[model samples]
Target: MASARKRKAAAQAAAQGAGGGVLAVKARYDAAGSGRRMRGWNPPTSGPNRAITGLQKIRDRARDAGRNDWSGESSTQHWTTNLIGIGIVPRLRRIKSKNRKQELNDLWDAWVSQADADGVLNFYGLQTLAVRSWLESGEVFARLRPRQIDAPLAVPLQVQLIEADFVPLLDADYWPGMPAGNTIRQGIERNKYGRRVAYWMYRDHPGDGQLSSAIDASRLLRVPADQVLHMFEPKRPGQLRGVSSLAPILARLRNVADFDDNVLERQKLANLFTVFITRTMPGGVDGDFDPLTNLPVDWGNDGLPLAGLEPGMSQELDPGQDVKFSAPPDAGTAYPDYMRTQHLGTAAGQGLPYELFSGDIKEVSDRTLRVIINEFRRFAEQRQWQIVIPMLCQPIRDAWVDAGVLSGAISVEEANDAKRVEWAPHGWQYIHPVQDVQGKKLEVDAGFRSRSSVIAERGDDPEQVDAERAADKERDEELGLFTAPIQPDPNRSDGDSSGESSPGRRPDSNKAKK
Candidate 1:
C-alpha cells in the first residue's frame, strides 16, 4: 500500500492533470465515495486566452454572490465573533523602557487612562468596526478628524470608518493623464516605488440613498494617505484594491449551506407522518384531501397532485386496500457526520478551527483544543499587527497623543516621542486555566518567561498590575491585614533584579528578621 503522503500527492496530481486517464484512475483509487473533482473548475488550457483574465469580473461576481447568499455574512459573523467577540477588544498600553525610565512611563500611563475616560480615542468602536470591515470586505479605511465639542475627550480624535466601496476613481478612464511613475488605481494614488501618496474619496457613499441626491460625483476629495489609513492584507505585491474575504470560499460555503438546508428540509419532512391509501374498490369516490393538512375535502379523492406531495389528511380508503404511510425518509445516520466534514473544510478555507467555526467541541480534548488555539493565535496576531496596528491602532494613538498634549492631560515631557506605546490586544481564555497556569508558573520559574510577560499575555498591563498590588498592600497594611503578598521567584531574572530574596519586603533591619 502507498503511504498517505504519496496518495495525497497522487490525488492532487490527478486533479491538476488535463487528461481523462488520470481522472479515471483517481476516481477508482479515491478513498471516499465521492471524487475530488470540484464543480465549475474548468481552467483554461493552452492558448493566449489562458492568461487568467477577468480578475475584476471575478471580484464582482464573488461579491455579488456572497451578498446574495447567507454563508458570506454568516461565516464572516462567526469569524468576527471568534476573533474580536465582546471581550477581545484591544486596549492601549504604554510600554515601559527597559533602560528603567519609570517616571515618564508612569506619566504616560496616567494620561492613557485619562484619555480613555475622555473618549478621545474612540478605541472601542474603531476596533470593532475595523475588524468587521476587514473581515467582510477585506479592507477598512479610517479618516481622522477633530471631534465635536461635546465629545468625551477634550481634544479627542474623531475616527470615521469607511467601507471599501465608498472610494471611487477621480476619472473612471483608468488613471487618466498621470505621470509615468505615479498611478491612481482604485482611488489610491501610488508613486513609482508603489508607495501610496493619497486616496480620492467621494464626499458621501455612492450607495447611501438619503445622501445620493446631495452627493456630488464630480467633487472628489483628495485626502492624503497619511490622513486616510487604509487597512488590508495585500495578497500580491502591487495589488491596490481588496477582494472580499469570502471571495475564494463563497461557492464552497454556499454549496455546503445549500446542502445542509436540503438535508434539514428533508429531515423535517421525514419527521412528519403522512397517510397514504390505495383504494382498490373505489371508483365513484373521486375526491382527495389536502396535500399538507389533510383538510376537510381538499381535492377530495382526485389523487396525488402533480406539483408536490405534502403531508396532509387523506380521504377514507376502501376495504382490502394495502397502503404505505410515508413522507420523507430519515436524513440518515451519515447526515450530521457529513455536515461536520463539510464544515471542517469550510473552516480550513477560512483558516479557523472547526470548533470555532461550528462552535462544537463535543469530542475535542483539552490538549487538542490548546494545540488548535495556539495555531490560531498566530493567525490572530498577524491580523492584529499587520492590519489593526498600523492602519487603525497606531494612527489612533498618534492622534490621541496630540489630543492629550493639547488638553493638558499629558505634559510636554510625557508627550515626547520617548513615551513609546504598545497596543495590547485582548488575550485568550485557556481551555484548562489551572493546568495552563501551572505550566506558565513552571516556565517563569525555569527562567524561560518573565512575570511581566505572563501578565501581558493575559491582556493586562504589568504596570497597572504593579500599581494595583501596591495600593492593595498599603490598604492591607493600614488595616493590619496580614495577607501574604505575591512572592516572586528568587531566581527570576537570574536573581539579578534584587539582592534580597523576597521582593515583597522592604530593606529594613526589623523586616529582615521576618
Candidate 2:
C-alpha cells in the first residue's frame, strides 16, 4: 500500500506532465474509480435513415478462405457424403383428393414419368453434384434452360446447375453502392421491399483461369429470380448467403485428428528398435568397449556373446557394463477411448448414429439402434422437407408444368390445377426386418395407416406397385400359368377326433386310409 505522500507525489507528477508525454500511473486498489467501468455501448447511427438497413454495415469477408480450409472441407465433405447418399432423386406421385380428376391426375403422372425418363431432371448429375456444392459452399445455383426440341426431354424445360463459386459476382463496390442503385450485395439484387429481384451470375466459372477454356467471358449475366433457383439454408432472418455446416465442427475435428497424428508419430518412433553392443573384459577397456572396434575381445565369466542385444530385433540398454536392458515408457492409455469420446461428441453434426460413422456396433442392441436411428431420421426428413424440397423438387416441378403448357401438351388450367404431386424420398432399410414388417402390418390392419402410405414409406409408389401386380397377373393368365396350387387342410385331413390336430400332420390320416 502507498502512503498519502506517494499519492500526493503521483498527483503532482501527473499535473506537471509535459504535453504529449507519457503519464505515470500509481498502483492502487481503486485507481480506475473515475468511471472506467462502462455502462452501455452506443454504436454509430451515421448513414441513410431509410427503412432498410445500410448495406455497408453487414458486409462479410469472402467465403473462399472458409471453404478452402482443410478441416472445414473435411467436415463438410463428410456430412455431404452421408446426406447425399446415392442422391435423393425425385419420385413424383399424384396425391389423391376428393375433387381430383382422374384424367388430370393421369396427365400429370404421365408427364412426370416421361420427363424423368427423358432426363429433364438430370442436370449435370444434379442429384449428387448440386447437393455436394450446396453442402460444401453453403449454396448452389440452378438456372433453367430451354429444352432442345429434338432432344429426348418430354418437357420444354431443362436445368443447368452452377456452383456457388461461379454465381456470386461480388466485388468491393457491391454492397456500399446500394442506395445509389449501383452494386448488388453478394450476387442477389433486392428491391425497396427487401425482396430478391434477380441474381448476377458470371458468364463462366470465376475459378477457371485457364487460357484455353471454352468459357472465357468475364461479363456478368443478369438472371431473373423466376429462371434461377438459389439453394441454401438461410441462417439469419435476412441472410443473403449461407454459412457452411463445417464452420462449427472444424476446430474440434482438427484437434482430434491432430491428436491422433501425434500419438501415431510417437508410437512409430518408439517402435524403431535399436541394438547396443558392449564388451566385458578386465584389461580390454576402461568402460564398455565398442564391439566393432574390439572384434577379438574376450568375455570374463559373463554371457556377453549370447545375452547381448540383437541387430534388428529388441532395443534398449540400462547400463553398458551391467548387462541389463532399458524399457521404454508405456505409450499411454488405450487410444480407442480417446477416439471414441471425440467421435461421439462430433457425430451429432453428421446427424447419424456413432455406429454408422465408426462402423462399431458392438454395444448397440436392436431396440436401441432402432430408437437412435429413428430420431436421427427426423433430422434428415426435416432437412429434406425444408431445404431440398422447396429449393430443388418444387422448382423443377414448376418448370415441368410450364414446359408442358408451352408445348401445348397440357392446357394452362390443367397444368396449374393438377400439378400438385407428392415427392417420396428414399427410405432406410430396417435392422430387424421381421419385426419391422410385423409392426407395419399391424399399422395397416388397424387402419392407422393406409396401404398406399405404407408402400410410399418404403420408398415405392403405390400406383407402380399395383400396376406391376396387375401386369404380372395378366401375363400369367395369358400364358396359362398356375401360380398357386390347391392345398389340403392339414388340421382337418379327412378325420381328427380333436378340433385341433398335432403340430406337423393329422393323426387320423393312417386311420382314414385303413
lDDT scores of the candidates, listed in order: 0.64, 0.61
Residue-pair clashes per candidate? 10, 0
lDDT tens digits, residue span 1-514, model 2: 5698899998888767852243323443343334445324444544222212322211121143234444444445555554555555444344344334545445544544344333555432464567666765667888877676555655666667777766553532344324445446666777767677777776766558553423222456767888888888776566676655544555676687778778888777766754344545565445444454443545656756423434576434334343324455555777788778877766666555777656679878988888887887777788878998788877877787787777776577666554566766666677689998879877876789998998887777687799898797678667666454223345444765442323333333435654
For candidate 1, lDDT tens digit of each residue in 1-514? 4699899999888777757766766767444334356444555453322231443344455556557755465567766665564433333344345433455444444434433333454456456767777777767788877655455644555667787767753323244334466766667777878788878877766666455433353656777887787887677655666666766686787687788788888888776766565435346755564333333343325674433444674545345555687857777899888878877877787888878766789988988988998998888778777877777777776776676666665566656563356666776777788998989999988889898999988888787799998898678777666563455565556534343544444434225564
TM value for model 1: 0.69
TM-score of 2: 0.66
Top-lDDT structure, candidate number = 1
How high is each candidate's TM-score? 0.69, 0.66
Candidate 2: global Cα-lDDT?
Answer: 0.61
The CA lDDT at 280 in model 1 is: 51
